[model samples]
Target: MKRFLLFIVFAAFVSPALVSAGESGAEILKARCASCHDLKGPAPATIRQLWKRDAPDLFYAGNKFRREWLVAWLQKPVRIRPAGVNYLRTINSTPTHQEKTKKGRKYDVLWGAVLKPLKHVTLSKQDAGAVADALMDLKPHTALVAGVTLDTSKKVSLDAGEVIFDKVYGCTSCHQIEPGYGGYTGAELYTAGKRLQPAFMLSYIKRPKNWDPKIWMPNLHVSPDDLQKITNYLILLSKEDFSESN
Candidate 1:
């Protein structure tokens, strides 16, 4: 009884601290992100401007980003999206629209080009760490997924998704989806659905090279069924209740 009481007391105290920490993350995001984002308006114009960029649909931040990745992102952002030169007939090695549209290149040329390290174009180490816990709590009001699985329900087969993820589309060559693939040219997708929406994934895949054609990742062929299967696989990879924890 005494131990339980102490535990309850600790929980009571810690919960408030956790609340305060969450508030701090909101503040930090405001100070760092508000100028560039508004969550409601004309959407962003450039991925760089935050105000201009339409990359992150932060309305789903809690749903999409992992606590650890979000924190690290604030400190040393890793570019999740590769370059963008698809629509434009831009010249060689010329910065793609995606690259041009983002807000940090000035920071890059001025602050990051020095190649200090941890090259994601947004946030410093200290700030990044602070944002993690807060961001995790920013969950959407939606209820649940009934626990996506690899072996149980027969809606989609994990092996099928794996086939599409690695073989048919050639996704493994650029993006790292699992421990097996060795590609590092693009952002890692090992936990994509955990951090991104299925619709968003579909759109991006449908138009892979559009944002940055010149970017190293080549837009490859993908079928609608394959896309759905892959999306299912991504969701499976992202969830926590599954038996096959990678």
Candidate 2:
């Protein structure tokens, strides 16, 4: 009777601690984030599959984001991509009235839920920290960022960077340098440096399809020198305060 009582006491006190310790950041991810995001990914294999995606793939988030940025973003969830992750669902055909501008050219207009503010589930500071810790544990694409380093030696003025982004590469068509500018389908570029690791930015820009197989971003075949300049430009851009403009 005495031994049984002792065992029961041990189980009651120690088992709960064991269970709590086992309930890690990964469990938090599975419980809360797995519903909307792709926690396990080979990325979308087809355009149809890509269109069906509801949220960004978090499987490689540790490889992609800065931990500080992730914590901040989760606490105050905001729209990073002007168009939702699935732009196919958010975009509409050109309207008749606006089909032809004074230049008599056609253009597609944004429609649906994305035009409104972001509808993500906001987290409390503590929860956000926990979630960020969980997300940082996910690092499936480690090889992609290997040996990649930010080239700080290269220097490009903001104006020169804009020219490269807009004229040389035409990235401005899909990504925004400032709020209310550029296309609606891709992520905002102004904050890319702040949000992403330098290695990740370099790697992803080199080959986006490698990261998300069926993603809409096409390889622009940027040269090595231009790539260095572009990445440096993004870091410079991040330093500028965009609260007033954004």
Candidate 3:
């Protein structure tokens, strides 16, 4: 009986400390997330510098991601960019033994670290909320996101959007429209509308080079008309419940 009472007393003291640790979002991020991601940034200035990047910069995450998306992603981490953050590090020239595609094309394949499953630090639901709060606190690029707004006046059907992405811009070569439906270099487009702020999307797509000078995403030289349509399409696409279909 005396041992049981002592054990209960220890648990009472330790449990509160554990809860406090879970609530320390800023501390958690500094300790855990600071290693790979750039919490502070002036994005890569040269191609060499870009290739050296180990992970995405989170300095502008507040201007980039939706809070709910951030929370959920933290709790159950998944690979958003298929070729990984630094594709230059992940890609390898096609091996001689590898079979060619039906079109007889032999393209480069992803190798090295990305070949393994995502290596992000997963968090408990409570900790995820705390970490997300800390991430949202980082908004260094307010000027970049300023005055940018989604052009809701434009409307494009899903079929029309696909044509623009696949045929017009050739975006399907990198980004996926549905699960496993496109190349493995870029992020999945299906959830972008929900995950990203429309303003950030518009700005980033307008000139990815401006956001990250050495990023593999090129300046598509997209016309304003097409830009509005593309942003509209992304918003429409985000409305679809991909989880249900997948």
Model 1 segments more than 4 A misplaced: 1-26, 33-155, 209-217, 239-246
Model 1 lDDT per residue over 101-204, tens place: 35665211112222233343365555566665555565552332223222323246567777778777777775766643545446667668766655556545
> Per model, how many backbone clashes are there?
19, 0, 0
lDDT per residue as tens, model 2, 94-124:
5763455688787777788988998887766
| Prediction 3 global C-alpha lDDT | 0.85
The candidate 1 region of ten consecutive residues with least summed lDDT is: 106-115
- Candidate 3: where are CA atoms >4 Å away? 1-20, 103-105, 244-246
For model 2, state the Cα shift of residue 30 in Å.
1.4
Evaluate all candidate structures by whole-model CA lDDT and list the values in order: 0.53, 0.86, 0.85
